[model samples]
Target: MADKSSSNAYWAANVRIILISLVIWFTCSFGFGILLRPMLSGISVGGTDLGFWFAQQGSILVFLVLIFFYAWKMGKIDAEHGVDE
Candidate 1:
């Protein structure tokens, strides 16, 4: 009863985190790099538009950062629930 509820809460929190991360990844890689490129044209990086930088490099960098962040966050979550390995 209580244990099941707690486990469900943990899974729900985990899924929420994953969904938020995915949204950010999508926004950075697709929304910024392609859909919003024209709107961001005024912002330049190395004489090229910011969109180009995001498409070519920025998104990947952000993805890497997100990976590390997710790992760290999940570690804390696991520890809180006594599920750490």
Candidate 2:
């Protein structure tokens, strides 16, 4: 019974982390890049408008960062759940 509950908690935490990461990625790639492009146009980054930068580079960078963050976070979660090797 305890093992089952801990397993459920681990999966719940994992799913929550995944959902948050996806939201961040989507907001950066689609929201800033498209929906809010006009609002961000006034800002500049790397000689391009903020929106363009996010569309072209920023989102990709954010995704890479998220990948690392997910791995690091999951490692901690695993440790907490006594699932780490």
Candidate 3:
């Protein structure tokens, strides 16, 4: 059925979007915040470790941004797929 096909497409699009967002989330959080902390040690923020800032605040901010981006992008995707109601 055409409706079924469109629904599948919509779901696929959503899944892809989520995967991309998660990769970005991990890169900003664990990668920069923990694994790469040493390299950024000299760049102090608020008189504390740059890595600490990334692990705590930066990640949180990036998460919020990703959440908003996902919501906004998915809304448009849904509308395009005629899945918005």
Which candidate tops TM-score?
1
Candidate 3 residue runs with Cα over 4 Å from true position: none
Query: Which of the predicted structures, 2 or 3, would earn the higher TM-score when compared with the native?
Result: 2
Model 2 ranges off by over 4 Å = none
Q: State model 2's lDDT.
A: 0.93
Clash pairs, candidate 3, are: none
Q: Which ten residues in a row have the lowest lDDT in candidate 2?
A: 1-10
lDDT of 1 at 64: 100
- Please give, for residues 1-85, the per-residue lDDT of candidate 2 as tens digits: 2399999999999999999999999999999989999999989887879999998888899999999999999999999999998
Error of 1 at 52 (Å): 0.2
For residues 1-85, what per-residue lDDT tens digits would candidate 3 score against the true structure?
A: 2498898898899999999999999988998899989988999899888899999889999999999999999999988987788
Ranking by TM-score: 1, 2, 3
Best by lDDT: 2
For model 1, residues 1-85, the per-residue Cα lDDT tens digits are: 2388778888887998899999999999998999999999999899999999999999999999999989999998888777787
Against the reference, the lDDT scores of all candidates come to 0.91, 0.93, 0.91
Evaluated at residue 35, the lDDT of candidate 2 is 94
Cα error, residue 64 of model 1, in Å, equals 0.2
Q: Can you give the lDDT of residue 30 in candidate 1?
A: 99
